[model samples]
Target: MANTPLIQTQGLTRNYPGVVALDHVDMDVKAGEVHVLFGENGAGKSTLISLLAGANTPSEGSILVEGKPVSFNSVSDAQAAGIFTVFQEFSLIPTMTVAENMFLGREPGIGPFTNHAEMRRKARALIDQLGFDVPVTAPVAQLSRAQQQMVEIAKAFHGTPKVLILDEPTASLTDREVDHLFKTILKLREQGVAIIYISHRIHEFERIADRVTVLRDGAYVGTTAMDDTDEATLVEMMAGRAIKDIYPEIPHNPAEVLLEIDRLTSRGVRGATLAARRGEVLGMAGLVGSGKSRIFRAVMGLQPTRGGTVTWKGSDITNAPTRDVIGAGIYYLSPDRKSEGLDLAKSSWQNLNIDLMMGREARGAMIRPRALRTTAAGILETVELRESYRPKAVAQLSGGNQQKVLFAKSFGHDADLYIFDEPTVGVDMGTRAALYRLISDIAAAGKAVIVISSDLPEVLNLSHRVLVMAEGRVTAELTGDDRTEDNVLRNFFNETGETV
Candidate 1:
């Protein structure tokens, strides 16, 4: 077969007022290959993908599809050209069935009649091809993160796309699910479909990608075959510097109990109870929909509790509103940072000051803009984001930097009990280490911290004690010193004799 590029970009440049997102970058993906885009948080990989996906138009440069230069005015235009994109934030509708979402825009119709049965049949075939066993008629919201990701992949395949783009698709998947996705990608590669895989997981590129492309500071570094590279070299290429071990050893010496939950029950959590002490970081590890997040959400008063008693500093705070909870010095940050934790379209100053203005601190209906800027600037400085950026859009920041912004918001509040849900998803090693250090500092400052994460290594390394949840129940409480990935996995599953 002749080597004709399926999609190629020559000098793709996208510029904002002060930020040149992608600067004269070149990228190419040939038929029957998996091309990985590797970069740090703010390295413009997402911007390049957005341009290719038609989410944004390039300020300069050109894109050629099958040797024909084209301008993709919208996503529909890209779809018409056989290019499909699956983003980290799923586009599946919760109320719709899997089959419905899979063939959303181009539903099969027989003589002006919508064929639901045929839709399910085709959806089932596509899902089976991907090695996933989800029911076609099931609502997407009820499915696990892995299942949702599988559906997203199925949707892309349903488009019969010649060029497929996946942005951080494995960020929320389990190890087993990741293996399944790898198998599906290999199958796609065999079928002559060009795949563009974007991720920060350096190890994944070695396993599945044929060629790796590195981008840094909005420019392309080089594209190298995976066999010719090592992870350390790739890390250096992405960050422009040598990165040593990022996770610091967590200190010991836990103090007295800080917050205690006698019995916590909610719609999502079924009669759960846990505790965290001062100067200690507690980790809640569980599978998707295992009720780990519910416990934290219930404590934060975001969700309604059926029956429970939450004792903070020896006072009952069951079902208390968030205002009182924040007033009592307890705060929670959601895993979905863009939607729940940040107002992305707003300026950084606005997002950082929203929580402060809500509290009794900023009393009037109208906020003091100068004072808000001062406070937000202080938070940004403390989190090490102000030096590099201030007054920029929070959404425009990279995943790691956005996470840092969320952390800064929490720190600015100076909450007594800090609950973070999946704090480091889609973040690079260097930034993850920085976040871990900051979390440790929060605990070291005599505040209780709860980290809810599926990444076992993070939970094991950052916490003073680890709590495992399964089937909406607290299965075991293990000391963090003795915790490992294998140990946590063993405890999470049944048929393993463990203590709680």
Candidate 2:
């Protein structure tokens, strides 16, 4: 008899009102293998996972576990069948302790009575086993994002799941934390656990994936052994077209400095001074907690500056409120799109119209709904965002599509300077190309742009000049011959004797 697959889906499909999220998709996961799912946002990766995890009922298809058909009407049903998923959006209760959050619904207890000490003991043991330093009794809200992610991982492993699904698990993790996660995943594979991994970071496939599956436009494109496929092939499969260049050329004729920061000091930034000019892209690079984001936050007036001077177009706006900063033709895009950037519950058109409607032009005016819809349609078209998704809640769109909406909102205003923090964090290659072109277009039009990213190649390729930050300070500023990854890393680590 042939070896039975751990989990299998036959002719699976899902459909929204006007969109086929998934279509006749067939997939299989084998025990002791890392099966990776690669696709552009909206290609149905999340939809398929939702069906398998019992979060959604498929329109048509069947799922089998170990060659036996099964139905999962709820998340608990999937868990009972030894399937667990750590979704991108965490499910932990922030106010609860780590131990309580881990064993949330099912606690160690006598009938109708909970055992707090036993829960803490088990949670602590799990954390230790995973090499994570998180207090079991501490509130989840007080922990950093990385620590909370560790808690999510620990929760997924609660019942020794037969099949584990991890979706963008390492997006917020540091390099060291990522290593720990990979080690744990390998151990799970050794224990014959079938793992379905989903991520947009292409660099991770070679490190962990055994077999690769590509999805495009809600259909299965193909599957290949990881070693047999190259990045170019994978990109083509995911995008359904060739993407020659991921980053556009940097602009050369930069105008006079439009924004200046002198001796800026904030909660997480210290004495950081930088200048951004029209027609220029100033890239900021640093590891997490190195204070890169703090600098941007201070500039956007989201954080108060202890001491500094912020001058824009010869006007001093130090420690100004966010509304005033935005009113003065400065736009800031936060990295956390779900909370800080876009309102998830609202439709795409509503979110896209926010900045425009807030402007002085729309003040005290009765903007027609038809006009708003027309304008939103035009903006979405310019960004290559699908018109079909324009009326849907932004939360229903894929990560890339939601990001496109955020981009549209930023451009909706007539801003002079644009600051984007990790704008392409969860976007795919195709959407990334579109975003790069948009940024380049903004610079070519003589508007200043600042790109703060953790992706080294992204900063190096897109920035006209690069700034390296370490411990709340700008260590090195590079342009021309001095701009390279090695130099950036050296400056990031505070290595001495490197030209700044």
lDDT digits (tens) for residues 1-500 of candidate 1 = 22898899999999999989899998889999899998877788888988899889999999999989989989889989999999877788999999999888789999998899999999998888777768999999899776888898788888888899999988767667788889888888999999999997776887789899999888999999999988778878887766555556666657887688866778667677788887888999988777889887887889988887988888888889977887788888889887688989876667778776774362334567787677778778777775655577887777888888888888656777899999988897667877888887787788888999877768887888888887667878888356877777876774343225
The alpha-carbon deviation from the true structure for residue 60 of candidate 2, after best TM-score superposition, in angstroms, is: 3.6
Please give the distance, in angstroms, between residue 106's alpha carbon in candidate 1 and its true position after superposition: 3.9
**lDDT by residue for model 2 over 215-311, one digit each (tens)?**
9889999999999988888988888776466777767678899899988889878788889999899999998877889987987888888997999
Rate residue 421 of model 1 by lDDT.
Answer: 93
Ten contiguous residues with the weakest lDDT in model 1: 491-500
What C-alpha lDDT, on a 0 to 100 scale, does residue 127 get in candidate 2? 86
The model with the greatest lDDT is 2
Residue 372, model 2: lDDT of 70
